[model samples]
Target: MGYKLSRRQFGQLVLAGTVVSGFSYLTNKALAQTPNLNIVGIGSTSIPTDPTAIPEVKTTESYSTHQSSVTTDIPPVGLELVLRSFTTGSTQVIADNGTPLLEPNEILSGFTSLRDGTLVVAITPLITSRRKATPNRLTFLGASSAKTLIVSGLNENQQLGSLLGTNDGRLIGLVGSKNGVPPITLVDINLKTGAISPLSQITIPKDKRVSNLAECPDGKFYTSLLGFHGETSLVQLGSNQEKPIVLAQLKVDGQEWNNGLQNLVCSGTGQLLAFGAMRYQTPNAVYSIDKKSGNMTRLENFDVTQIALVPG
Candidate 1:
């Protein structure tokens, strides 16, 4: 027969266990909220301090402007939805399969497709008020009765970086400086009410400015840090960390290490890829970056001007 306990004894035992378990649960919750800011460099590729030191890699793919068929279904495996901006101040959403989604009149700096198929766009102004920065606007397009304004008042000093869609109908974006300044602010945008709230902010180390920022699948943010001395490294930002954590130095041979990097996209494959266009008229290459080690793997060369990835 199983051992039986007295009524009072059983009650006391249950209470003790509950108290212990509750403490353990609260401890884990606190630890989870804290971010580890340790730098983890994996590859032996020495991070170059000189901007002139570019990684040497042969071009494996060519740029093309062909569009594939559009579908209402979720993008297929190995393919993602993309937003391509033109020099004429026009923006169009295209799938990795080459399907055209939408074109708008305003210049879109960042965009994200929500879980409910709603499209949230960041309208980046071409002109900035040098005297004082003004708020950028967020517009809602498609999946609604008509185009609507969602939120405004993004960071004015910093041009808006890539926007990442969240599972809860919210969006995350970076307000990064164009002149290599510090204090890149991470903000949250609501799709329903268009409210904007800053979750956290981190400044880069001296001589380093963020080129592009993307949301990793694990809820952390990452960016490509361009050094004033001509070096570039990938770094991660945690909500609890006050400073950015360096992941790995990027290898950009023959590519402009400065503002040439654009359209940083976090993919479902747990990597970030972007168009590394050194300058106009130069063949651009797509490179994939590992979030953990900051290592970059060149994918293929393509000609699209600016490409945004579909949110995973």
Candidate 2:
């Protein structure tokens, strides 16, 4: 059977420096001066246990911060979710009245925020134990409450990908194979029922995979396609366009970025931001992308897997 960590026990693990060490808080000088930009990210720490079994929670401990009294209730078997906020030169966990807005035994698959500042997250089971089955869920975390709804329409083999909230009040998501293959279809997610409706099928080269998705203020959808050998391309997607257009190959300075870029978020002011994953001994960093040129400017150095712009 699976085990759940109490709020206090979770705090002890974090206080022991086991949970937060995987994430780095290094901020670039350019981002330190930007007081107006605020970003929220979802990060994970993997605790290696028996891959075929879930571990039992042993101890209980508590953690406190000046901002809020922190308590965590996630299981300690596979991936522990961390919800973080990034500002000028610091990163901190987001809490609500002594409780964190997180779920247990789940991995963050996709993230997005609505125009009214409502945050939506897509999660799937960690699947640490072979004997137990865990259902996929969608959580709507708002100012006063958090509601998790069971995802019904996805097949057992299908997996949820990046999520985007459009200007017209629709929630869009990418649904694709669990192994991250091609034929990633665009789907509309019902915020009320967690039902998925097919929008359009996205076609990409077999050599590449879609890593992240974003929608600009102008209503155009964009996605990052990562190649097998560290090559990355930014492509534009639309129903009106005959085919996807390659905007630019992502590069920093004059060279292609070998470290892959994941989580893509378009800020309210029209700035495209992404978290660059660690690769080939290079550290993780946050960058702002030039939509037209596909050039990236380093904003900060932080190891975050997924990022969403904090709605103002």
Provide TM-scores for the models: 0.53, 0.71
Q: Give the number of the best model, judged by lDDT.
A: 2
TM-score of 1: 0.53
Candidate 2's C-alpha runs over 4 A off are 1-35, 46-105, 126-129, 201-208, 281-283
lDDT of 1 by residue, 146-169 (tens): 344545554433456567666455
Worst 10 residues of 1 by lDDT: 16-25
Give the per-residue lDDT of model 2 (tens digit) for 182-212: 6677788888888888775444333446767
Give the candidate number with the greatest TM-score.
2
lDDT of each: 0.44, 0.60
User: Which stretches in model 1 have alpha-carbon errors above 4 Å?
Assistant: 1-106, 128-135, 143-146, 154-159, 176-180, 201-208, 253-260, 280-283, 290-295
